[model samples]
Target chain A: MSAKEITVALVGNPNTGKSTLFNALTGLRQKVGNYPGVTVARKSGRCDCGDGLIVELVDLPGLYSLAAASPDEQVVTDVLLGSLEGSQQPDAIVVVLDATNLLRNLFLASQLAELNLPLALVLNQADVAHEHGLKIDTQLLSQRLGGVPVVLTSAWKGEGIASVRRAIAEVLNKKTKLARLTWPAQVESGLETIVRAVQADTGRAPSMADAQRILFSSDAHTSNRLGWKLSQRETVVRQARDQVRAAGFNPLAAEPLIHYAHLRKVLDGVTSGGAGKQGNAAALDRVLLHRVMGPILFTGIMLGLFASVFWLAKFPMQWIQSGVDFLKSVAAPALAGTPMLQSLVTDGIIAGVGAFLAFLPQILILFLFVGILEDSGYMARAAFIMDRLFSWCGLNGKSFVPLLSGFACAIPGLLSTRTIEDPKARLATAFAVPFMSCSARFPIYALMCAAFIGPLYGPGWESVVMVGMHCVGLIFAVPTAFVLTRFILKVKPQPFVLELPRYQMPKPRDVLWRMWQNAAEFISKAGTVIFAITIIIWALCYFPRDAQMAEKIRAAEPALSTHELQARTQAAMIEQSWMGRFGKAVQPVFDPCGFDWKITVGVLASFPAREVIVSTLGVTYSIGKGAEADSQHLRQAMQEAKWLSGPRTGAPIFSLAAVLALMVFFALCSQCGPTIATLAQETGGWKWAAASFFYMTILAWIMAVVVYQTVIRIL
Target chain B: MDWLIIGAIVGSAAGWLIARAIKGFQARRKGGCAGGCGCADKIQPPKK
Candidate 1:
């Protein structure tokens, strides 16, 4: 066992647990970035294969072929040929084939073998294969495919992984000769003629194998690399077409998808299952994809998911809040006499950290549901059901995955937009993704629900109201996308052609691992970014205190008891602080939205993020740092608060109409800082970020005004 | 108001410098972008 290393590229069809396998092998040695010249992320990691051999694994984006039609596919082709500038050629390629769909998986595998690269065939999900009563003769399959070693693996059960790893090491160490595809005679002759023509046109030399691939699958990058104009390509393609015809083959025929026919033959002979009838996957698909039942099932799934998020997050939210409060309480006694230290500890750090901590439950619950759906292979079914709806809204079906995931956070959702092949659809999905009513906006919805809607409506009705607010965000996104498509953006919609994979019970280990990873990421990210913003927000709301005004308010609070005294002191400080004055200055702007100066302060505070609205409201109503406290007392206080000037004068500033309007506005607005930052990174410019902000803010203002004006008139 | 304006100016300058430094680092890491290679050379066959 020498201490040696191998470079292996893991290739597979999308949703085949390629990532899960890569994560298992590489652990923490992963580095991710966009592939050169495209927005598709490239994930590479290194693993120490037992016996001191280091295996650097590159997990290429799952593509159906080496016949590169899209950027993701082109990436696979580029790395395999050692054409990508910053990347080295893989020493051996590990083709991960789904045991269930051996025919489809072998299409790309057979194509890769033709490139003369060392290859190992890994038939993954053997456990699933066995359960479904399928059998594979690995020896026969390997011998049929030029004697390449075939390893059967159940990535879930950790069965046969060591064999797969050993196969990869053997291929790399032995430099095993790859078995080339046996192309039909007619196709081979046509490819040869095109290769000769391409060679004669350019003086530089390329391998016959390389030239063949370039003719069929070369992309914009490849065309540029080969120094071939469209005219030249067209001439070559015409010659190839003529050759095919002269040999009595139809150029346009879909049958004999050339390499696929051979792969299918290999699959039919080697694998056995679902030969006579459809299996469990087909049975589940019957109802899940049924025209009428599909939508109903989707609706049920979505309701169940949202219900879980709402209920499951409550306990964690309370725990996080209590933890923050306890920390602040512990620090209070140490800094009693020091005013600046006291404010910095309790107001800046504690308040800011608490605001972020409260979102843990929402992030966890949302990812939990997403994990279950994705792992069970139901996400594709969901996309299939919603494709027509999304297409009608001028978005592609691929946009639905990211948008649904946006409920947890928009950053990853925006990243997931890479699945949308069409550039126009990708941008549109990114633009509209922020309107999916992310967890950051949950605090605003909760506050309005508790303050105005919850009591009058009851608990179940409040849940509906909360869900309705999310619906408002989603409802607004479609029309906005439609308008943007027609006027501002104007990218043609890409056709939706999503594949639904077979369903399996989500592996509990994978689900729990995902939850732990996401929760840790959420807490860590919140600690840094949100913590900094919270401190800035505290500073904005504190300081520049009117010395005389503070004294005047303190004198007025003397008659109050100890608890009341603390409450009054907190209020007086806020009223005399810089934030109060700023709120007063902007109060006129918020008047039409039916907000007074205090609510105006909350709105301003929420611009960095929407969830701060809850804490802002909590502080404004003197409900203490805790929102779980007496709701009635907070509501009464909010109801009794008066405005400096209004037509109705002294009327409750936040009537039902006003509260509803605020919720509607927050629902539609792109106020999350991370979303804006991601937009800048994804689009690679501030123009899109600024444009997104401008459009969302304007839309929010208009919608809020409309809701308030119409409702106030009715009342 | 004066201090607020000054703070805004400082923040803008700081953000710009950070952005510039990151760009410089990326440029160095990528080593001059995607296409500056000759992997796609075409071969000429011998005269028959």
Candidate 2:
């Protein structure tokens, strides 16, 4: 299997460690896409280099230079000038830098050594640059640069990653020349007649670092991504900016004054010492950046990360709810001799993909506490302690890391509001980080807090009503980010600057590879969007095929009571199919919240995700009693769901005021469907995801008719 | 056998509605997201 490979890439700058040396050279393999039409992220990974060769790597995103101005630095300057589309070019180039910010990471390794290519460097906090006393000789910075290979790594003391894989396999097995540097005879006599008029109008040669950056990069989209010769490359880049301003330089500051005067003669005696004051990251950023104990220690670390995702997913959500009810009672009597293969194997693939993979231990313990609060930098000091409450909502602190990644989902909190530069505070932090509560509303707030608020409020007020219904999306994401950035996206409030890095100690394999890459993208969308919305709500409640309500429930089953003949033949095959006649023709638009047509067909088949309404109420109450979801027989058929007529006739339909009006209609709705197709692709518009799904479905039906008429008038 | 168990539940609900209409025609030809949320980067393409 030797179809040979090389690629390389891994550039750096932002909190260098270049994704901990591409997760210490591709650990759990790797992938993470993007960079085509550009929301940037890219990632990639492969790494064999244990000789049979096969490196790949990629990584990219973090920029600092190669003069790219955003669209994630024009996909890291069109994938390091291989010119991006379906990428390839990167045959070498490691870069990585940051030995305690070595001269602004050597101005992006001197603009990636004038982009000639086959580079290597690394440096990476060589033990926080020898714990600040700094030394960094690396064989006199690789013999004053010409023979590149620098290394001296410390990706947090995993020391010199085998001298950065034998200096990227000796800069991909040698023979790469051009290290000339010491330029500036007014930028080499203004790039020698625009590098010989871009090598006599592009017959090759023009890469004197793309003829000294198209003579002073006035960034005409990086001179049409350096293809050149548009009208003899803008009349030889305006006659080499009038001969580099008649040799006195400043052809727009002659490429950062001749790359910091040839990095001050190759950093003199190749860097020596004198650093000191890291006084324990400024005395732990003085009380984690305190101004009155930093918003009370960032609201006691976000109420101990949402009360330890319901007290550490209560014994692994009861051992993944008794291993999805012992694989639905061992596929119920081996598909009990077919009632459409026992309703497609215990209600369409074991209660709609095992009730969304029993919230994979509360999504890997809330992505292992947001991957150790974003790898120990205390999530940018919780966006510097929620930048004074996201600056009274005109947003700042870079819209607090996409409103703290909408608690873990608003489509990566609307693609991390592309790190908020301010298209009206990134569309008012992507229309207020989908009002937060994400881990797909943690199993619809853990199966309505364990079959209706933890056995009548026990597990300590069922984790304080599951951290106040996951703070109903941070209490309506702070007055909907202050009335959508103060009167619908007006936006002027920018000031956020943050930084706060130094707090190292996080690597438990980068917090279990970011909690198994966000709990394997929430258990691979429980096999494709919760197994195709739990088999189209188990084929709209198992078709219009009632078979005479299974022969008057097997001739009124021996005076009923196999739990009332499996609850009156699963409530007369859910009041005769088509999802109970479209949940009784939208049961008077969910009749003031006390929903019935089985909680309005599990909130109309969980509009494409909020944990597919607990496996569509475990496929309308255990179809053939295979016990659809977290069984205790579908929580005693939702605690004997009743109310067949008006004025709450026979009581029960999960009472406690219809399970706190179905957890405040799933903590204020707009029932998912990929968070309204990622708010119509991050607000270009389906009129702001149809005004955020008709203002959160009329604020989840007026807060579930004021929490089910103020808790049925306080009981 | 009960019409091959109603032809394997109508061929598993017609292969989950033709893979959800070929995943909403590949998220409307990449106007993006059908990768049900952890987007895995590169979205943008809609603004013309």
Candidate 3:
């Protein structure tokens, strides 16, 4: 809003390093994922473009053309045409192009040239172009595009950034707009008639670019944006199409055909290069993308990633556990007088937070590997491999990223469904995304595996169980998607067209940043939502303390050891508490799954978040003073737990069947509140979200019972 | 006195959590993200 400030928009094709350049120029650490569609919305930041000139730089979503096809692309088209409400008409445009692929990249630039905005062309990825032996003549390119400023930049390497900043400053100050392309008389006349018709209909004249968009768009997206209905403008639009047809072009294809023709001439001698050595990448793709070998490699990579997360994070998890125990030891005596206060701080806050934080190391490691895979261009190949499997279920390769993102969290995964253009496909993918075993569920698996599976079987088997638990949801998700897309939704199959970026070394800085950010987010949630839930659960399990419970226990077992007596008293009080009564009431329903009242309580309390079960168990099982109430202790407590009542009284509660059943339930159940809310928003109503919830819960319960019953008999 | 203090502490924690839950429910009702996962923050409204 300042007179001295000018807004410049950064627009480019997907995967052209526009975000990287935006980060470099503005000094903002906007996430820079190596894949396309990472940025789904416009992000703006301020930069001092020298001479005391403050530039407000807006980074728009990457699009191939103004003829937008998806919502994400429509955002860019709307912003560029100044039609998006509350968005400023940019004072200038910065067209960021990939230096290695000038011909294709220039097509978009050519369309922007027609907008008559002050323009600067940034030939980004200069280093890659140079390595590929590409030589672009900036001088000739500038002259060909009406002497607009052109600068070469390797954004990731911070090379030529100063030149880019200077070029932007020059364009803003001089108001040097790029020369517009002259169209053939037939096309020009057709566009003019459409413009006149629009003005007459709305009593307002539209810019020529808007007129062109309305005349040539394959759909009614542009017309809708102009607030003109098809009934109002169908005749003029048809007349314009007739003129375009007479000009020897199809109305739908005219814009690209004309723009490319102009671009071909404009770049006649402005650059030269063979498309670099794809030899290395092509050879890797042979095995990585092979029908048989690719899936094998993907499975191997995922197994190794999970195993590494477990093995590498073991030490840090122990350290955190120790820290938790130490804190409890220090606080127990300090709040000893107020038994309730001691219980709240030690059993509720510390135990819950510690149990969640213990898994932080594993979560961080998982994020690190995910970031590396995304940056190394292997994710696209993974999606390519998955396309075959997904196709049978009517989902395409585009759903792979959203599903993969679900492994980290489901909210962003649901948001990323915007990239899938087919409404049925998008809806089905969103419905299945919550079944992807997000990191929140990892704590449950880790606790279960480490406590029961690892100690009993061995670490190697533990790793396999860990991997299998991660896959349990995915295994169910495929058929769930199949049912939704093929039977219920009857979604038409869409071809998966993905451009695989050239493989490169993963940048350690970006990878580490992603890991740190995700880890911090995990910690933040633990301190807030998980913390609050734990306190409430603790209160539910702790209050209405029977004043004579300890006396009664001592009278019932007069010869018991001091530790034993205290443990009995604590157990009795908890059993008589509010949560305990509710758990007992629900225990019969889960009895077939081999879950006792305490396990049932954990399951029921964790509906808000799957991770809360770990903390809930931590609080539920807290008995002795200054007990080692970390995950390790919680695991020990679970192992020692026995069926207190029922036909199977005094039997060990956490049998192999029970552990596997619990893990399976958490894997398949739609337990996270945020995920359910996101599903409702993404699917456009609460109907599908509610269906997903009830269906997944039912399936999980049935599957859990089957696992428990079958495993118990086998054992 | 200790019992009263414990009651107050527990009551305050429960109150804060309920308020947060209500706020989250209202946000989801309004078609906004439920807030913990950082999606709501990343999505900024278009500038005027």
Candidate 4:
């Protein structure tokens, strides 16, 4: 630890603007959302407090109390006590309180007062309180809290941030500790007993705050942390609860009752007026959260967002395609003498990159809508709506956040399962999270829709198909979770408790920043992973050049043009190449799913990451080809593809059934390597990961085959 | 000569990709996010 650096922990209840304030203090773009559980891990950044003093700010997960009901809450409890491994006790604490709802927020602030650590109270959302016509007397509150510094802040607007920094510096300089509340003598005695018992068990006396936590918490999280034997801890806890009963108080209800009573007196006259008349939020929620209308509105919003993505991104996609074609045209002539180089540059790199990049605008637009949804506070309501559906399946509303996050990527979504208190529910949610149709699967759906569905059935059907593909995974995921929770895990139903934040207009800067970040990430993957995969696929499809194959084709068809002879030779060579042979060997397995050898090869090559399928198809179709210009685009190449063997020989390979089947397979398959590994870590074994992989793979195959056969029969 | 050059470029790409995949697998096995989704850095444990 540097002499000039002091660590301050930011603690608050969920949706109290703790993360927003953390971002403001550190100037780092930590993920901030209008809902709770958005931040499930500890994040820290340094702030220059101006005067050669650097403050290391640790942003802990949001929790209602220090009872540690969930894994994320345990992190906060562990960090505050300096018991978390590799972390020191914070030098000071900044307790963020929702200024408009101080009475509820002060419950957490009251508990922190007993820690005897230097503290500052940030009445965040001050702007909201002001707009609500609520007035807080900071000086009175500070005086009541034993001279601790108090500052008002509206973090999202960057209002009063400088005052917050000054308050932090002042609290540290003055070493101002919050005034501790007086507990009932009986409760105090019970706490003393637990404190002594803990000291005897662990050979160290615990702080009063820790003693209170152990005595009052219904869960064994505190004793478990102390490494106490279950039998011993239970006996000690029972004895302490008996003491509380002697004072006519239930041990479970005693802490909140005592704290609230004391806080009511201390905060008397510190706040005046209320937001009054329930405001616009209440009026809006009446409609948005209405039983019948909420779900219908949600469906409509989802459809509209996806339709906009397809309709809006079409122009940019065409521009990118044209640019790629131009580049290929210029490079083809320059390297005409070197056929291999020409193919590698024009067919492998440019085509592969272009195919992937054309979907960038779609990905960006989708993220922009998601960002607005998240920032507007509608995500919580959506979760509230989903809870009714999830409860029957043995999961709760908390699982919805992680499931929603999975649409962005499964890694963080799996990690966010820490917020679910029920072990069985968490595991079930983690198992189903990978099936949320992540953004990596978006390009495949977009390409299939654009190449076939759009042109055939118009943009309306294209948009519907795009939305349907996104829903395919969720449609399957719910049933999987139901079976796991009911038949295997037998999870008990848990209540969904969520505090909905006020609805606010989406911040344009944040939304655009999110879009830009996601777009850059997509571009980076295209340059690296997609680039490498394309080169390898191109090589595999272009090797063992046979000059006699062209001659044989020319001799067999005397009327063939030179271009036709070259195209025939290239196709035959690809069928004979290493990847071609491998794909053919595996093609039988996917034949029932309406997949040709080329599609099978692309699917196999994308096992490491799903998005590589686009690049793989690009390289497979473009290598060793002449500049026909018409077939340069990936969509054109796919549309022109035909089956070379079997009873369906000479028929178009990508029928509507086949295209839909391909999209279904990608949507359901557990193909992402990192997602599988994350599942292993979260579930505490590789067995669960293995089961998920095999189960999803078989399920995807069966579903694809079913779609293919049913659709083909109908057609 | 063009065949040799193409083979070298392809082989090098294959070799590099193989090494990267192996490294990523090992990292993921140890509970690190190698998802290449730009979240690994953000999701890390608190600094020592």
Across A105-171, the per-residue lDDT of candidate 4 in tens digits comes to: 8898888887789999999989888888899999999999899999999998999889888988888
Tell me the tens digit of each residue's lDDT in model 3 across A1-715: 4533578999999888999899888887767776667787668888777877778888988878777777778778888888888776789999999888888998888888767889999999899889888888999999988889999999878999999889988998788777788898999999999888888888888889888888888678877777778898988889988999999999988888888888899889888875677778899999999999999999899889878988999999999989998898898889888877887898888887788888999889989998999889998788788778888988866788788778778887888788887888899999889999888888889888888888998887777898898889889999989988989999988777777887888889889988888888889888877888888888899877789987898888899998788767777888889998999899999999999988999999888778889888888887422244423467777888887777878989999999999999999988988788778877888999999999999999999999999999999
Candidate 1 chain A lowest-lDDT run of ten: A30-39
Share of the reference A-B contacts seen in candidate 2: 0.25
Q: After superposition, how far is residue A400 of candidate 4 from its true place, in Å?
A: 0.7
> For each candidate, how many residue pairs have backbone atoms clashing (under 3 Å)?
4, 1, 0, 0
Residue A478's lDDT within candidate 1 is 87
Quote model 4's TM-score: 0.97
lDDT at position A299, candidate 2:
64
Q: Compare the candidates by DockQ and give the number of the best one.
A: 4
lDDT score of residue A616 within candidate 2: 79
What does candidate 1's lDDT look like per residue over A440-522, in tens digits?
A: 77766765665567566665655677768878877878887887776767868666556666667787777776677667765
Question: What ranges in model 1 sit over 4 Å off?
Answer: A1-5, A28-40, A207-210, A217-221, A252-256, A275-279, A319-329, A450-452, A486-494, A550-572, A608-654, A684-686, B1-48
* Chain B TM-score against the true chain B, each candidate: 0.62, 0.38, 0.70, 0.74
Candidate 3 DockQ vs. native: 0.57
Q: Which stretches of candidate 4 lie over 4 Å from their true place?
A: A1-5, A629-631, B29-31, B46-48
| Model 3, C-alpha of A178: deviation from truth (Å) | 2.6
True contacts kept of each: 0.00, 0.25, 0.63, 0.65
> What's model 4's lDDT at A384?
84
> Model 3 shows how many backbone clashes?
0
User: Model 3, which residues run further than 4 Å from truth?
Assistant: A1-5, A557-559, A624-632, B25-34
Instruction: Kindly list the interface RMSD, in angstroms, of each predicted candidate in the order they appear.
Output: 16.3, 10.2, 2.6, 1.9
lDDT of 4 at A364: 91
- Superior candidate under DockQ, 3 versus 4: 4
